[model samples]
Target: MSGNDILVTDGLSKRFGDFSAVSDVSLRIQRGTIHALIGPNGAGKTTCFNMLTKFIAPSSGRITFNDRDITAMRPADVARLGLVRSFQISAVFPHLTALENVRIALQRKRGDSFDFWRSKSALEPLNLRALELLDSVGLTSFAYSKAGEISYGRKRALEFATTLAVEPEMMLLDEPMAGMGHEDIDRIAELIRHVSANRTILMVEHNLQVVANLSHRITVLTRGRVLAEGDYRTVSENDEVREAYMGAGHA
Candidate 1:
């Protein structure tokens, strides 16, 4: 990988039986930028995310993160390198308070055996940082609220707090604005912007408006291939991208 890029993929491809879900794709994500991958439904965005996160193996490809090859690394191993993802798949404990949920995630990062409710100094120290993370995501007021009792938007923010606890150098956000009302969307957008100042972000989002607002660069996928890549203004003006969205009834 070039020093300019924190992540690079060459000819990434994935297959399910004989069906090709993603075909020969390449990407270079620069360090300290918000890069977005977008497409109409069935455009292989999820496949690429899975492959990059080490959730699934690509049929043929090479992925390098910060000058290290990661195509063969396991998911946990990749996460240890500071390439972490946060989304619904990252379970938030329902009964745990917002602060406690974040504390658990922090503890997991420490690899300490969970001695639940045990009066140990090891677990107590995490609370301070956990509360700080909650504040970072604008959830300080809900610190004592049960995770399940919090609003959906706040829960998502809590998820982000936990993800941040891991101190990721690169974060893959899964549709951060999905199902959010305008207020939540705006809040999360600002949160994303704030957190992205010193880290790299690669996200797969369907909300074009949010994508336009946050993305430093955008890649458009169609039928499992990259059809266009550039800034939002550039990709939005591309005839092929418009046509692809129109044909998929997304335009």
Candidate 2:
């Protein structure tokens, strides 16, 4: 792995019985860059992402992060090393207010369990940082609202705030634009761009326009293998990519 690369995968493959989901894939994600994994439906994008995050074990391969082999690490162990998947820590409490939810996450990061029996005053120290996180994601105005009462877009913003509380060095976002209207998509996209200013981001998204606009590098997968890897313009112009998307009845 290059000095600039924060994450690397070698000969990564996954199989279910006789079917291969991801095959001999390798990747080098550079530090502080937005790298996207995109492909048509059933192209193993989710399976590959699951393996990278350690949500599911790979059939065969090696994964290294920050120069340490983490292929066998548990999801929480990998997350503790500063590589976190968004929804992994975004178990937002519906009954809690926005501020409370983020504060709980901050407590978790500090190796403190949320003390439900303790007085609210005890959590005051974490409030400032939690509020800052909420503000960063444009959720400060809703800080006192119950998380379940917020709009879907704002709920997603809440998720971002909670994720930020963990202080992940690299964030893996899966289908961040899924099930969103145009305005929500734009909001989340800007939030992503803002937060990525200081950390590396890897995302799997089907929205080609969002991928083109946000990704510094794009990896295209087709039928369990890498078809291309490059910037938006280069990958967009590749004949194989064109065939994989256009010829296979994908847009």
Candidate 3:
């Protein structure tokens, strides 16, 4: 792999008995870039994502992160290695205040188990950093609000905050724009851009507009295989990509 690549997959594949969900999908996600994996429904985007994050084991192939072979690593172990998945594996506690939720994630990063029995003062030291994280995601004003009570957009932002607490080298976002309105989509898109300044992000998103606006590169999948990959313009102009999306009724 090139030095610029933070994550690489070689011939990644997954199968369910006689069915192949993903086949020979190879990717090279460069450091500090926002890369999107997009395809029509049932295109194996989710299966590929699950394997990358170690949510499910890949039936074959190898995954490398920062030069380490992580194909067989467990999810938590992968996360601890600074490759974390957000959204689909959200760590936010809905009933907890946004501040508390981020604080818990911070505690986890520090290798400290949740100390619910401890007094509030014991955890107060994490408050400053937690509040900073909330501010980063534009949730400082809602820091005291219960996570479940916040607007859906803000909830996703809070998820970003919690994920940030891990100080991940890479983040795999599963449909960050899913279920979001225009305003929320814009907010999260900008937030994703801001957060990508120093870390690598690989996202699977259905919003083509978001993919075009935010991604530095895109991989198009169809029928469990890569149809094309390049910058938005290049991939968008590919004849095969156009036919694939149109045939799948995505456009």
Judging by lDDT against the true structure, name the best candidate. 3
Output the worst ten-in-a-row residue range by lDDT, candidate 1: 242-251
Error (Å) of candidate 3 at residue 208 is: 1.8
Query: For candidate 1, lDDT tens digit of each residue in 159-221?
Result: 889888888999998778888899988888888998897999999987567889899999998
Per-residue alpha-carbon lDDT of candidate 2 for residues 1-251, written as tens digits (9 for 90 to 100): 58899999999999999999999999999999999999888889889999999999999999999999999999989999999886522356889999999997788755756567977787799999999999999888999999989888888889988888888999999888888899988898899998897899999876667788889999998888999999999988898898886465543
lDDT of model 3 at position 21: 99
Considering TM-score, where higher is better, how would the candidates rank from best to worst?
A: 3, 2, 1
lDDT of 3: 0.89
C-alpha positional error of residue 164 in candidate 3 after TM-score superposition, expressed in Å: 0.7
Q: Model 2 scores what on Cα lDDT?
A: 0.88
- lDDT (0 to 1) per candidate: 0.88, 0.88, 0.89
Question: Candidate 1, which segments miss by more than 4 Å at Cα?
Answer: 88-90, 108-111, 114-121, 246-251
The numbered model that scores best in TM-score is 3
Supply every candidate's count of residue pairs whose N, Cα or C atoms clash at under 3 angstroms: 0, 0, 0
Clashing pairs in 3: none
Q: List the residue pairs that clash in candidate 2.
A: none
- Stretches of candidate 3 off by over 4 Å are 89-91, 114-120, 247-251
Residue pairs in collision within model 1: none
